[model samples]
Target: MKQMTTIGWREWASLPDWGIVIRAKADTGAKSSAIDCSSIEELAGDRVRFTLRLSLKSNETLTLETPIAMRKHVRSSTGHGHDRIFVETTLELGGAEKKILVSLTCRKRMNHRMLLGREALAGSFLVDSSVDHWATPRVKKALK
Candidate 1:
């Protein structure tokens, strides 16, 4: 039997390609992870550009562009449905990095900027909701 790494309900992660770090929530209930963004614009040839706010309290931001991995119809908790754009990016979780598909959306109302869904967590982690930020320190050092 192989041992799996356990992660907290919330941890710090980064999209290293864009040099942005965000607090993420591990949500097994969600099938796909999401990132908060503003100014989402669709480009020609199946590409997208958006501005990511590093944190709610920070004025700093990063603009990124990536080819569309796919488009997904996502239903919100309030039963509202939205067509979200999915893009591939490398996410550094704890000390490990992996390429994950993340849907871009407006998450201004959400507590965390990012949500780590089951697909991103599969085979790589075990969630322990009782803990928080177990991977943040390691991720911070790697990002530096």
Candidate 2:
């Protein structure tokens, strides 16, 4: 059996298409991974559209329009939480890449910007609450 590598409680992550990098809190308390999003809409066919507003530890802002390949209703941290829409995307960390299923939601009230939940970190990263960004190096967006 293959062994999974571990990660710290917090790390710097990049949303490539969004042109932003944000400090992500690895929350084992959270069941599903979530990203801060706004202007969500259901497009024709199997696509979902939304604008991703990002903030890094540096407090830089970047807005991106992303077309989601899939969307599904998912449960949340609280009991019987809002039905969120999931998007299939690649999360690159610690020089390792994996395709992760992330749920999109309006996180206007949240502080950290992005939350990497248990499901997303499972079997891939082991979190140490005492540390921050010990695994993945901060990656910036590609200029297109």
Candidate 3:
């Protein structure tokens, strides 16, 4: 078995077939991972749909609409949390990739839209708080 490795602040990731580059924050404090999304729309059944966009200061914005495979109750940052739709997908970081379950939430307000929590980082990475953005930074979407 490959021993899990540690990662710093920023890391490289792709949505597998989505062909989108996403930067995630390595946060052990969180239980589950979270991603930035917009145009959230609830579909029939437990599935939810939304657009994943790349937000960077320099590049033009790139957006893609995707749907959640499942939804479940998840604890929020606040002591009191509720059930939220969770999306299951592979998260690629630092040339390492793993299947991760992320909760669907609006992270537009945060500097880093994506956050990799313990559930996703467990046995995969060791976090170093002293350093920032150990992985190469990805340029934002190129405007057409």
Candidate 4:
């Protein structure tokens, strides 16, 4: 079996393909990982475009377009079912790198830029709610 790393409720993640290092919160309640994005536009050829909010503390944003991996109907914490667009991206977390499906949504009020859900954590990480920031992002620094 592959050794799994234990992470805290909060940590950092590097999306090397997007050239962004953002803050992430580990949430067992979520079924899939998510990123804060806005102005989502579904395009032809199964592609979707959106703007990623680089960090909670920074006003920086990046507009990107990528092929849609899948479309999923997800229930928010508020219990509203919404269709979420997912795109495959390289996620570097806790010294492990893998392709993970990340959902895009407008998380303007969320505390973290990214929310790491069960699907992203299942085999790679074990989360400890009592601790925070147990693992740092693979990148040197995050956008502030």
lDDT of 4 by residue, 1-144 (tens): 988988889888878999877878899999998899998999999999999988667688999999999999999989999999999999888898878999999888988889999999888889989987787744446653
Q: Write down the worst ten-residue block by lDDT for model 2.
A: 56-65
Best by TM-score: 4
Q: Among these predicted structures, which one has the highest lDDT?
A: 4
After TM-score superposition, the amount by which residue 27's alpha carbon in candidate 3 deviates from its true location, in angstroms, is 0.9
The lDDT of each candidate is 0.83, 0.68, 0.69, 0.87
Tell me the tens digit of each residue's lDDT in model 1 across 71-98: 9899876788999999998987767778
lDDT (Cα, 0-100) at 84 in candidate 3: 69
Q: Which stretches of model 2 miss by more than 4 angstroms?
A: 16-20, 56-80, 137-144
Runs off by more than 4 Å, candidate 1: 1-3, 138-144
Question: What is candidate 3's lDDT per residue for 14-129, written digit by digit as tens?
Answer: 66865666777787878888877677778766567676646644333435444676667777666767666677888776677888888777776777767888899887777777
lDDT of 2 by residue, 1-144 (tens): 656666778787655544455667889988778887777777766567776656533334444444564555666555665766788777776666667777778776677667888877888777888876778654455211
List clashing residue pairs in candidate 4.
Answer: none
